[model samples]
Target chain A: MNNMEKIQELRHFLARYDLPQDRPPLTLGHPQADAVLGGGLRPGVLHEVFAGNWSAGGFAVALAILAAGTKPLFWVRPDYEAMEYGAVSPNGLLELGGDPRRLIVVRTRNAADALSASADILGCPHAGAVLLEIGGMPKCLNLVAGRRLAFAANESGVTVVMLREGAQAEPSAALTRWQVSSAPSRADDDDWGNPVFDAALVRHRAGGLGHFLMQWNPEHAVFTTHPGAVVAAPAHRPAYPQERRAV
Target chain B: MPRLPTDRLIRRNGAPSKAPLVVSGKSGNALHVHALEARAARLGLYKGQPLANARAMVQPLAIVPADEKADAALLEAIADWCDRFTPLVSLDAPDGLFLDITGAAHLFGGEAAMLAHVTGLIAKQGFAVRGAIAGTSLAAHALARFAPAIVPAGGEAAAIAPLPITALECDDKTLRALRHAGLKTVGMVAERLHSELSERLGKSFVTRLRVMLGAEEQPLTPRRALPDLMAERHFAEPVVTQDAIAAALLGLAQALSEILEREGRGARLLEAVFFRADGKVERIAIKTGEPLRDPKIIMRLLNQKLDALADPLDPGFGFDLVRLEALLAEETRPATISFDHDENARRQIGFLVDRLSVRFGYTRVQRFVPQDTHIPEAASAAVPAQDRDFGPETWTLKRCPDDPPRRPLRLLQKPENIEAGFPLAPDGPPKFFRWRQCQHDVARAEGPERVAMEWWRNPGLTRDYFRVETKAGQRFWIYRDGLHVQDQLAPRWYLQGVFA
Candidate 1:
């Protein structure tokens, strides 16, 4: 075909189908438990997660958001050291086919500016998600500021994730509040290596709650499902000897 | 009255047609002319006599030359001084001023009170002045010259009735013609038919008369209008030293900050003027990296700016007045302070960058932003350091992986063309290449990463880039032009950058 004909063909091919619009909904590690809770966390609402011994769950949630096709994720974590999180590298999300330019890490002066910037980002329609590290926020930004930020997020169609430092009993404007903790999946012996405890979802929006067992593969920088697993009721006996004694 | 000669000799041998000055051959042979009829009567001189005979009749008469420029300059100074009452003062002519004191009247109690105040002030300066108020400037001008000091609204014609034809400011020839025509007052001229008036003396004369009677409205040009954002501080006593000026600036900055905070905005550029007591003024200005309303921070920035001023603030006498104005403003959200040490360090870095930018010039400091185009030169743009918003760039090297790959430490400002042959080209690495009369040899070589220019822009050339290691283990990025064609010129080579 001639060059002009080839150009016309390319244009016709491009106009054949519209681009895909489906995006994966947020995957709250314990799917069954989250399903029991009201249809997973509300799509575009603020969710507050209080930090515990293992801060890795928060980092996992951040990656999940990016993997869900959320473009331009604003990470406003002042106290959480990005380097320690193991995904602070510029191309950390490249394995997921994510655009490196879409990830923005803002090193704010303090929790105040971080919260303010998070609110501003949430109010902007172009933003896909905003993660506010209000672990060290001043007392001034308590309930009132949180409600304002939530309103802004709702109006702009942006998801907000607040990373709290310590255990807080109540959340002002969070649609779903969860507390994450670490525990072993099972006591079964695996040939590969010793079974380490996978982070568990101890609390959720609805009354339902559970835990997931997973093994970390540092070499590939990812986590895989444990070989053998056991599911138990909320008050069931601990599977590990050490966990049972502690309980 | 005494009988006076109508014709007399002006020069030694000629008799002029116009009236001449009387002169006396004896007692100094002085020439004298009667300017005022009262003075001539007092001096025993007749009106129609020749100057030679009049001087013979009256001795020791004084002659004074007229000073027109000095009179105009004095009038201009009076207009400038009138600024104290209102900034909208304008000079009407050589001897008149049109002050638009509509809103300014209340500042001095009322309109009549303002008129009395201005007249008293000018009278104190030893000048004879008259002022009239009317809706239109033309009407005001005519009334101030011929009519009463205060003309009732819409009564311009009646107020100017008894005045002579001179009040119209007609030329000498026009005045003589009017007098010859027996039209002695402005009221008489106003009564004449408009068509007849225009045919006899042209349209301008009639137009001027119409304008003076409020038939048309005239616009007044003011001297100074209010600025967008201004803050002024008047000290109890004049200050001279730079320290005093700096202290006063703090107060002004606080005032400006309060206003900006109330309006939910911040200033980007600010200018400060010092009106010295000795009639001299000094001005200094500064621009901030971001819009800010913090007085302490703004004062600190201004202090650095003041230190960088080329001209020293001597304050020769003292400065009694200081004014601060905001030239540009923008809405900004206040930042919160963090307790984390690393985060604090980052904030400190932003401040240091702003200071260094102010000292080195904004354009000199730059940040790199990646562009989407494939062309090497079009892949990045250098933006002002202060204006850069920190974020990841979208574009990447075509062959490079999405990792922290090694890159050249320094990129040449511009590419240099070279001719490579023998050992340097044709499928072989160079043993030695001459660059700036210095020879360098290749120790290792990496492949040709092909990069093509954007063809849509214009006719483009393709490049084949290679990473070559020298004997010293220093790697250099070099590229070659389009490959050889049967009828085209040979390819050229250039060294683009060096990796540390």
Candidate 2:
């Protein structure tokens, strides 16, 4: 068989052994990004967002997705993340359109504990969305853990966002994976303009990869698109060359 | 009962039948006897004597290591058993138990009969017990340990006169000083002038003497709260099965519910105390989220608690008395429910939370309550789920629909320090910030929402917070501590929380 045929056969085998990914999609409110994703972001399935250079952009996107639903959000974070980076600023998120009152924060000691809590939160139907934030992809979050999260999210129909910091795009059971970075906000009379996000669809199960420049309009509580803008390369880049990542 | 360290371990394995048993603790270079069994006492081997010397005096002696925890647990169990006689049972540890029979004694015929019944019950369990009844706990304690088996009413002073002054439960130093002062017995100590005794032994010695002489009655502080209402059932034959216990609990709960209904009250906390025939006692307590009067719910909760115990309630031969008491109760009136299903669902959630908390511990199951505070970490407090009704007032973040909120959905427990590069002005948001070794250039910056320290609660540096979005879309709530006021310390920046 040709390479394409062999790959198709592998996908069929994986579909049977692994959890089902068919679920209603959640719109990210960006047309181009949604079109590339075949529909929109799928709910009841795990989705990973890598914080490329800037982690806040990825986290903002996660919150933006969560703000779509009115149910309570359970955010499980590694304790070290609070120590290393910073904790969630309730005031900032509130201003960003996510209700601080409906958020339940669960802090675990490590990435493994965070993942476990994420799986537990996904099983609760009352949790509108479950966000698990970790510094990097720990070894414990293997294929098995990913499948378990997918299964739980599917059963409870809760959107699960796995926010990873300084993490490369890796293959997993996640319905789609994206890389997000902060973009220059569109200028206005006000000093600090609308929050713009440079988001790229790095991986998708159904296969179309695309990028979109998104801006958060707090007045309407929705994302407005900026026509075709990618994140500018960092001025002072890392000493080591960036390694090619697997989709 | 204050046991010499050694007595605890030996008591658990049952009393040493033949050999003289002595509990020993290490003293200086050799093992010293801390407590002596009756046989050892009879053999003239007293407590605090070295083991080598004790062994030299007695040929065959049984020894065990000291265990205070096991002794305390045993004391608690025995106290539970005594609850069958009177709800007022408190620990007189390391070896004694105080049972305030008072008005309860008449139910068992009289005080003498009640004492005999208790002694008989303990004796049946293979334990040697010396019990006494008096108007006060102090008199009863002294009489039980140092004087006769029973002190007659209004004859407490005369009855305890012959007992040695050492029966005052004083330290060895005081005992030695009392002996040196030629006060050999209770009678001798009582004869001395109060001023003279207080001058030499301090005021406590005079107070102790007064309490023991029945001059100043000492009240008994019951270990468990005196139940608001109680109902108990005595079996003609001891019950050894779990089913029997459940039936007894249900019966008691129903009877207690009737009494509670008359007063328009419901039980918040209920305890089922089981007194075993073998003198062992097992207690199961249930706490409800709201006041409850339903006998069915009470019985179900008790059963759940009993089943959830790691060390299952052992009938230990058999239980003869099952007493159910409402340790805590609250006023209640029938509420008219708009929808029965909603009320039922709410009750079901409460019951599920209570059961889970009881099984896995309350700390593991928690709920958050918002507080009025600007210090991000102090905005919300997590409390045990069961304590949700501890206060009547509920707090939510106050924000107008049209106005933007200043708090994030999730706040970090502790603010983290980060390195950043900013303008020389030292007042505005940073142009670039480095957090967790990742640098982010400013793409968007918002105002410095200054949150002054709660000086009334805690004095702290005034913080100027800025909502800054890094070049990569990462939003951070960074704050510069201290103000730009002249003569103020240089303000340091900290990453308080994230926007997402």
Candidate 3:
């Protein structure tokens, strides 16, 4: 309202760009997925992955590894996730080329607790990435909670990947939305191969959407896009086919 | 504290009646007086007296039932309240406390002022109080019973000499024997030779006498561990508002940090004690991953814990005293410079872990540490992040180079049973299986990998494991109960975990 206060506000606005949180996008290494993502998945924002089983859970982990790099990755899950879907194994993570030593797991009692814990985890700039796995559609995960999480993530510049299982897509403040599931591996009968994903970029705030059948190379821990397998879909609406089970 | 049972009752309700009150309990088959108020003791009534005889001697007697449990709890509560005076307060059983104020007397001016302050406050709460200060606990215990006076150094003998021999508080048999030996006063008992006293009263009694005479010293066993460092604030008027409580805590934290800085040490476990004006106490504790000395960080963790408390801290009538104590401490480690911001980031992560642990629980926030073993389930264990004693962990990949992950990403604590049958071969992997009410047709399969149990472990069943991929693309690692033997019972199948 006054000239001096206006000048101070302009100075505060000018100071924010100097922060190191404004960095380049992290490439997912998949040509099709990266191009649709406008180069790649951007850091310092909220990303949501919707799926029914551990197949999508694994993909969420792969994205977390990309965002986290060599830093600590905190995975917060409600206790119901373990009871129904099984516990998250350290050996499984080690096999997937993620550092188990740099991982911290917080198993909260319910979705409310998981959300609060993730908020705290995201506030800490030291943590490179935080994965929050919520089970059912609890009332606590409303738009306000989503907006609060997004604000915290933006303030600290830590990437947050939320794995929502067994719930319908709801409106939120996430930057990108994904629908992922497991796809058959490209190996013969006697050889069980690497993890393959049917990842659909349903919602992108800054770019268009695309669906790619990607296979993960666990030895290198990156996605390898298969050429000529783009599924025909529209981006104006939420992606993924109707009549899908549960999620 | 002498009539604690009666005092507790009288404190709960005002004095019930004009008649003297005695707490009675069952001794043998008859009711006997267990404890009595001062008014009752002044009459012919005394402890251990049968009710029938007491009622026959005095008219209009009042009797109350004895509750040992309530009495002990009250004593413990009083001991907790006494923690404000000294951290080394120990219970002296049924009705007394021993305060080891070896170097703490100066805070209350001197021994005389502290004694007067403690007894005066306790008496203000409507409990009869008597206290004394001496060179040793035994001397103090004896003097407080007969005469409430402070005994100076090297005056232990003269101070207790003129008192009756009962002041020594020896056994009744020993007192009767001492009286029979023409020793009515402690001075008369002290006149005998050491050998004569030991021969008559026994060696333990003589040692007790020596301890009482201040010729020997004994250490007091405190009821709780003594804090490494402590700082407290005493309010002239009790504080009830949130702003006042916060200000008090900030002050105490600053004081504690100053002390810590002078000693070049930091605290690992910090506790806050709130002594309420209504004689109730509340304690809150927080633990850290590393030795922390910063006041701001300490207050932040405390605030986080306070917010996450199941029932928020209530200022019942307001707190009269607030004390901050470091229950555990360690020497501060100098920060090491790294090529990147790794060191600073690690410290920040540690603080975050501490905050989350306080909000959730210590066991809920954990890091995976690789164990040195061959067993699948025992390969890694989640240790609480607050404790750094687990040491370094280097994960060794179970799979060979360029091969698919042999281990499942998420291992269940225990395996669940599933129905499977119709393998390509008798010992081959199952063709199809039913799990969680869904039937999955196996398109690709690998295994019959036999894993025998170690000899040192419990004789668990040796399992033949398999990794099967369902036609829908979900991969599962399942195992058969035992080996394929001739004429053995049919082996059951179990689903262990799923591949990510």
State the DockQ, from 0 to 1, for candidate 2: 0.19
State how far residue B13 of model 3 sits from its true place (Å). 3.7
lDDT winner, 1 or 2: 2
Each candidate's DockQ: 0.02, 0.19, 0.61
Which DockQ-derived CAPRI band holds candidate 1?
A: incorrect
Model 3 C-alpha lDDT per residue in residues B239-287, reported as the tens digit of each score: 9998899899999999999998888889999999999987788999988
The clash count for each model shown is 7, 22, 2
lDDT: the better of candidates 2 and 3: 3
Q: Please write out the lDDT profile of model 1 over residues B94-207, one tens digit for every residue.
A: 567888877778867887888888887665544445778876788788777665467666788777766788888888888888899999998898888989989988899888
Q: Give model 2's docking category.
A: incorrect
| lDDT-sorted candidate list, best first | 3, 2, 1
Per-model lDDT: 0.57, 0.70, 0.83
Ranking by TM-score: 3, 2, 1
| Model 2, C-alpha of B383: deviation from truth (Å) | 5.0
Candidate 2 lDDT, A1-247, residue by residue in tens: 9999999999999777565557666666767666766666777778787776554433444543443376656666777877655555544545666655555566666787677767766765655787778777689888788878988888878878888887665557787677776666544333555556776666666656666677665545666677434643332332113312443
